[model samples]
Target: MKIGLYFGTFNPIHIGHLIIANHMVEYSDLDQIWMVVTPHNPLKKKDTLLDDYQRLYLVNLATEEYPKIKPSDVEFKLPQPNYTVNTLAYLQDKFRQHDFSLIMGEDNLKSLHKWKNYEVILQNHDIYIYPRVSPEIENLELKNHSKIHIIDAPIVEISSTFIRENIKSKKNIQPLLPCKVWEYIDHNNFYRK
Candidate 1:
């Protein structure tokens, strides 16, 4: 089976995430999209990030309805400062029967040259890039690479940062979150300052 690994912190999974996962499964060659919930991103600040387990739980709640798109806590058991290269290598070793690909945005592709062993990643696996609002990644050098596939997926403008800000101000974030996830966040008072 072909699997696409969509790695993210998932501080709170939102509609945009769901839309992309659904699109990857339905429109792309990916048989499944595993939402790899990273516990700690090497490049991001952790102050605003929810606890790893909580973020993983929210991801699970948000993706529960989609069988093809599920939450993966694989990083939680791995080392800190989770890097995509390490996770990909570990997963490849463990799930040899499945073909794994990386799912990311054009923005990430623009900065991928800075990632650990990026050249190795490009040579070994295909990347499914989705459109982002940013214009900077439009001129990426790797755009023409045979391993790069631009997916015409639905683009949702929502971001986890926006949802967290709204929650902090006691605003209704229901529109951006799945119903069960919204309820869980509401009941647990997550992302409150």
Candidate 2:
């Protein structure tokens, strides 16, 4: 099984996220795309983030209908501030029968070197970079590497932070989120100030 791991905080899984994951399966060589819900991203600030399980639940709700996409809580059991190299290593070890690829945005390519054992990550797994409105990959070190596959997936300009702000201000986020996810947020009263 060839799987693409699309890791994110997923504060509330939105349609844009589903769009990218679905596109990965349809356009890329991977058989499945797993939305790896990160408990804590080493590079990001954790303040104001939703509980890991709630975020995971939202992701599950948003992705449940997509046969090609699935939600993963793999990072929940791992140590805090999980490193990509370690998570990838763990996944590779447990799923020996499956080939794993890292799914990321074009913007991440520029900061690859800042990641822990980033070189090892590149050496072991292929990286599928979906396009973002941000500037192109400026990191020339690995620009031409065969392991880096840059793909033009459909871009969604909206972000989770924007959705959270809108919710806090009592604005409707139906257009930004999947119906089920919006319903879940409504039921749970998430992201309110």
Candidate 3:
């Protein structure tokens, strides 16, 4: 089976995320799009992120309706400062028969060179990149071996940081996240400073 691993710190999974996951399964050959909820990403600022379990729960709520979608907590038990290459390697070993590929935004594609084991990741798996409008993906110095596919998805500018700040300000974040997730966040007073 072709699995697309969409990794993110789903501080709270929002509609924009749902749209992309749906698009990947609806349009691509991918049999499933696993929302690999990362506990800690080595490249990001730690302070701004929500607790790993909370984020995973929100993603689970958001993706529950789609059988093709699964909210994965695979990275939580793994070592902190999680690197993509390591996570990919681990998942590959665990699910030996399944074909795993990376799902990311065009913005990440721009900084592909900086990721741990960039060349190896390129050589081993396919990357399904969705557009991140602000950062237009102009041609980077192309590596000869990588397999990259660009996907045109509805460009939603909603960022987790912005949602967190909005919740902190007691602003209505209902439109940003799914109803179930919003309810959970409100009940738990998540992201409130």
Candidate 4:
């Protein structure tokens, strides 16, 4: 099976996330995409973050309707301050029958070298980059981008941190998250400052 691994903290999954995953299946050769909910991202601050399981559950609830998209706790069981290289390594070992690809944003392209074992990850896996609004990849970058496929995904500015902070401030976040995720956040009284 060819799988696109779109890893994120999720915090709470939203429509923008779903759209990208759906687009991956519709436009790409990948059979399925596993929304690998990272328990901890090495680059992100965790002070405002919710419990990993709650975030994972929200991911599950938000993505339940899409057969090709799945919510995963794969990173939950992995080591702390999760890095892509490690997750990929673990997944490769566990699901030997499957081939994996990396799914990420265009901005991430500039920082790929900063990631752990980035060279190995780049060489071993196919990368699918969904473009953001800022810039287009130039030809020189294209040579480097050859190992990565760029797709123009819908650019919604919604962010999990923004949503979390909005909830804490008791601001309306109805437009940021899926209805089910919003309900879950409200029910759990999450982010109440």
Q: List all candidate RMSDs to the true structure.
A: 1.6, 2.0, 2.2, 2.2
Q: Candidate 1 lDDT (Cα, whole model)?
A: 0.89
TM-score: model 1 vs. ground truth: 0.94
| Candidate 1, residue 124: how far the Cα is off, in Å | 0.7
Superior candidate under lDDT, 1 versus 3:
1
Better of 1 and 3 by TM-score: 1
Give the per-residue lDDT of model 4 (tens digit) for 62-169.
Answer: 888889988888887887877789999999999999999989887887778788988899888999988777655563253265678887677767777788788888
Better of 3 and 4 by lDDT: 3
Query: Which scores greater on TM-score, model 1 or model 4?
Result: 1
- For all candidates, what are the clash counts? 0, 0, 0, 0
Candidate 3, superposed: residue stretches over 4 Å from native = 41-48, 143-146
Clashes of 4: 0
Global Cα lDDT for candidate 3: 0.85
lDDT (tens digit, per residue) of candidate 1 on 1-193: 9999999988899999999989989998899999998776656777888888898999889988899998999988898767788888999999999889999999889888999999989998999999988777667789889999999877778999999999999888798899999999889888898
Better of 1 and 4 by lDDT: 1
- Candidate 3, residues 1-193, lDDT tens digits: the string is 9999999888878888899999988898899999998776656777867777878888888988899999899888888878889998998999999999999887888889999998889988999988887645665554233488877777778888888899999898798889999999999887896
For residues 95-185, what per-residue lDDT tens digits would candidate 2 score against the true structure?
9999999999878888898999988999999999888877556545676888998887888787999999999999988889998889889
